[model samples]
Target: MVRLSRFVRQTFLSFVAVSCVVASAPSHADGTAGWESVKEAGVLRCGAAVAPPYVMRDPKTGEYSGFFSELCRNFGQNVLKVKVEFVDTTWDNIVAGLQSNKWDLSMALNDTPEREKAISFSAPATDYNVSFVYNRNNPKIAKGAHSIAEIDKPGVTVAVMSGSAQDKAITAVFKQAQIMRLPGNDETRLALMSKRADLLADANTTNMLLTEAHPDWAVAIQPNPPLAQQEVAFGIRKDTPAADIAVLNKYVSEQVSSGAVNRLIKTSVQSMLASNK
Candidate 1:
């Protein structure tokens, strides 16, 4: 009788264990719980901060555009079969917004070790590096300055967008120079134009736009090895399933491999230049 009781108890325990495992398993075979939630809602929310060529918002019409935003819209409408919503945010809160579930993806975030601890990233849409933009005739900067050390000296001031990757990078490297952190890209560019700052530290591509806008005065220099050389990717919550990330990765890979990303960038640049003119 005791042997019979023991057998029954063992069987019950086994059944319970199996039930628990089944309950814990993802409902979908793809392991796309997060994505499923997004699909159910019928909208893919993308967090955006205005970093030109990456993210841009029209001041008058409140429309969102730029390469990354375009990718977001395309991925949502075409790949996920949903509507896209751009949630305006600042660089300081872009990652936090993703963490809090305020948005499904943070657009155009630079994937770095510091951010990886808090959130996951999709495959890179493009490479990113920091460069310094300054007036070619500026007496503070050397005629042929190619290294950061030449710019990192007392009495020289460098302007960067507040709470941006370039801000953090230049802060670490420029011990002797004053780092003037502004709230936005326009503010930083205006600082350089007004002589409030001597150097504008920003993304290499962004500085390219600045130089193009003011070719007579603005010129950019990329450091030899590069600063904050990293990948710009979409930021998602850390708990996001690998399958969901894979979907994003595949889409980004397709765009990059087919040269679609380059076309988007060119279009954005041309639009920006035309507006400036």
Candidate 2:
């Protein structure tokens, strides 16, 4: 009986020792968090595409400033404790940059299935309701046409920003339209204002901003139900460590819940509008 009791005690003690060893070791065995590498590199390479009010880059100064730019700076300074190096990218090639490890984080990116194959997105950072802006005097279609399908007929010029989710969305529903791919919102707006493009289709923010600046145009949005809801978020490579994804998503949710993100958005929009004056 004494020998049996000693054996049982020894086994219990061995189990406790193994548990302690396992618990003391790191959570992951092989890979470090992607942000850990950023910390080690002393700078988080950030992708900033020139989507105004969302991301704006100064060419001469190599400076980035906008809602997403500030938010990324906050993440680098407060969360990662690293400097952020903004790399200018275009609407179409931004996901490619992330997939190729050119940037650690994308400032503001749309979540789509095509992009998901290359990179993973954080929880939604913001939402954009799609709208269509067009010249009221355009003679191609009825002025009373409301639905996108009504304007999807051939010869209707739809100006879309290349490499944008808007480009995809418009192309999907307007198969017969004459789709003109432009580089950015500014150019797309110009196409619509100059009557070269019959329709400027994109997120409400861009369309509304352009409509406000150009009073001659009219916007059509389905008020009872939105035409499309685009969720904008930050993106990282698919192989990014789970811990880093958790940390980034947590930080974004925290900022959103605390209303800081909304306030910053208002400030950025106001700043952009004021500058256009």
Candidate 3:
């Protein structure tokens, strides 16, 4: 009877201990299913479109470089303690890639309502200026237009990258102007350089870097500014658990506050200019 009682008590204690361990295990309430799968695989998949200043491809090594790529690496290496796998994607398919679970997140996208409907965005990591650029040889722009809107008219053609902030804004504000939607960011510059388009609409960093390389193009940035500033953020899937989004947002805020974005812009200008050479 004494042995029976001891065995019963031990069995009950063991069952309770196992139950407690199971109950205390982390779940979707605390962590993300996507992140959990990533952690298990030990690889963080990042979607990259390979746009300059934001995401540049190292021509020789087939490796990725630039501000957004570095930022993604920082998160994967430091925050998640995992290796990163950058998956090639295009801006037009960025949202679709995330929705299909092809990658965990997209890099340095300008957060917008259309994107928000397809996927979620982290808190504003940084903001960028979007402006117009024209070949210095274009006499109309050379006449010194004071306002971005001043250049918008029926005859003016603007070269824009498909599925970009500049593309959307130009379509919205300049109904009379012609928009030539190129396949990618590089093609917009080509269109302007070849005089196929009168103006090139892109982010300031891209315009600055290219202008430095060309010295033949001029930015049409107004002193008081023309367009509203756009927010840059990591693009995550909406189904990602809240904890993952919170982590990304916190890290982005810290990076922004630490002067990382500004530093990156300065460094990228130099590095990208060198790449152009």
Candidate 4:
């Protein structure tokens, strides 16, 4: 009986040891699932859309180089210490990709209500106001037009990219203006350039960048001020494991406090504008 008891006790101990190992293995696996993918891939796959001064592809170089892209690169290399791989995406699809876990983060975006439901945002990287840009040659739209209501008339055609803040705001304020929906910033700019549209509603920073390139083609209008200023942020998956979010938050906070964020915005915004020329 004593020998039998001894054998049963040893068997139970062995089973307990195996169980502990199995449980601990999953904790390690869980940790690996969060930030590990970024580290293993050696790159943070960032979803991005063209936003001109803020973010855009270099026409000549065919490369993603803008203020927003630079911000992501800084975060990845300097803060998170990871490589950054930019994935060009439409505004419509960027948020969706985050939900599907297709991308690690969005390079730059406005933290709107709908997006906030599915993704998280870091601290504001930049601030911008709404503005209108018109073909310089046409010169129909003028300064002192503060809102869409002021500029949008029966004959005027306003072009805006779908899924952008300008699109939403124009829809709300310029109900009378013939609203033309385009897929991306490039298309919207083309619409204005080709005289297919009278005015292009875009962020002030974006308009400034465009004006820099096509000095003779397009210009920024003002009502002696801008429509409104909104913050730009990096969008990450809402379901992102807490560990990953914590690291990103820490990095962003540090960058913001140190003013590295300001330098990136100033340098990259100008560089993007210069590249257009």
Candidate 5:
């Protein structure tokens, strides 16, 4: 009986030791599996949609530039210690691609409640607002039009990048005006410039560039209450661990605090201007 009791005690001790070892082992199940996979791959994939000053891609070289791309490169290199790959995408498919795991991150996504339902976001890198740009000489748009209502009239055609936040915003507000959903920024701008569209609905920053490019005719509506004001941040998979998001937030906060983001934006704007010239 003493020998049997000794064997039973030894078995229980061994079982407990094994359990402790399993419990203490690092878990990939804690929602950090995404980060683990990224680390294992040794490359962080960032989805890039061409939104000037936020993201830009060179047609000749296929190289990505602009603030968001630079930020993604920095995060992958400095924080994740991985090679960064820019996955070309369009605004229409940016969110869908992220959902499908085509990339680890989506750069310069506006954090809307609708998007929140689909994916999570890091802390905002910058504030964003939609604005309408039009040729001041166009008869469809009134001079000094201060509100969307002033422009939302019959025969007025508003052009926007398909599946963009601005497209959604203008679609919601413009009841009588025709909405032209083009596939790319260049197309939308061309629609406006060619007078096929009376107004171009896009980010205020983007409109600023357009207006600057054609100051003689381009005019951006400065609405008193702004339009679709929101936070622009990096998009991540919904299943990404909150801890991983916290790390990204910390990095974004540090960049914003140090004015690094502002500098990047300035550089991007300058580069865009130089390219246009």
Candidate 6:
């Protein structure tokens, strides 16, 4: 009976020790939150793309220099008082990187049902619209082609980037129109310049900036009205701490109200185009 009681006591002690270890395990939200991670690392890892005007990746330097990239840099360095590290990620992988905590934020993420489940977002830095563009001389379609229903007639050939929200939107709207899924925006633009496609629908902000720079190759607009005006915001992991998120949100809102964000966006867009030339 004495030996049995001693074994029972030892078993109880072992269980308690194991419980303490389990309770103290490092969690996904470890020592610091997302915001703190940026500060600790001395650089915010921002994911961006060469999606011209918004987040253009410089071909020559292999670095990011565009509206969204500048915006992230300015916000991190000035407002958040942290260093900014730009990570050039393709549009397809940006969301996954955010989920994996590989990238801290994205510059021009359009809020969608699929994305909402994956990441936390700041208040919209600006509104987003998908517009159709065509070559200036050919200008196959007018500016107001909002939906596939409006633009996708039998003969219309649409250029799309496969697996993009624009591509999904087009598929949802136009079943009859033939879609040419190009690899990227540059390819799509080439397709349009080469007269392979009558229309190219992409984020309106980007298309507008490109049109401003290269008036001959592309022009775009909302057909009747914008199909939807989505708020573009930075995407972080959805599990980010509330305190960190609050700080980021406050800074973004302040910048937006002060018009600093707008100015930054405009300047960056101009800078990107000028540098590209």
Candidate maximizing lDDT: 1
What are the per-residue Cα lDDT tens digits for candidate 4 across 127-152? 66678888756655655455555677
What tens digits encode model 1's per-residue C-alpha lDDT throughout 1-277?
A: 1133423343344334323322122322332336677777788889998989889889999999899999999999998799999999888888887888788899998877788889877777888899999988889999888898998999999999888889889888888999999888889989999999999998899889989988888989899878988888899888776556666776787798799999999999888888789
Candidate 3, residue 241: Cα displacement in angstroms equals: 1.2
Supply candidate 4's per-residue lDDT for 112: 67
Model 5 regions lying over 4 Å from their true place: 1-33
What local lDDT score does residue 167 receive in model 5, on the 0 to 100 scale?
85
How close is every model to the real structure, measured as TM-score?
0.87, 0.83, 0.83, 0.79, 0.88, 0.80
State the lDDT of candidate 3 residue by residue for 121-169, as single tens digits.
7666567667777876776564677565678777889898898777787
Candidate 6's TM-score: 0.80
Q: Clashing residue pairs, candidate 1?
A: none
Candidate 2 to truth, TM: 0.83
Give the lDDT of residue 247 in candidate 3.
64
- The local lDDT score (0 to 100) that residue 57 gets in candidate 2 is 63
Tens-digit per-residue lDDT, 1-277, candidate 5: 1133423343344334323322121232232336557777788889998989899999999999999999999999998798999999899999998888888899999888788899987777888899889888888788989998899999988899999999888788789999999999899989998999998999998888888877888899977678888878899988775456566776787787799999999999888888887
Colliding residue pairs in candidate 4: 144-222
At residue 195, candidate 2 shows an lDDT of 85
* Lowest summed lDDT window (length 10), candidate 5: 20-29
To one decimal, what is the Cα RMSD in angstroms of model 5 from the true structure?
12.8
Worst 10-residue lDDT window, candidate 4: 20-29
How many clashes would you count in candidate 3? 0
lDDT of each: 0.83, 0.73, 0.73, 0.70, 0.82, 0.69
Model 1 RMSD vs true structure: 11.8
Q: Report how far residue 212 has shifted in candidate 2, in Å.
A: 2.2
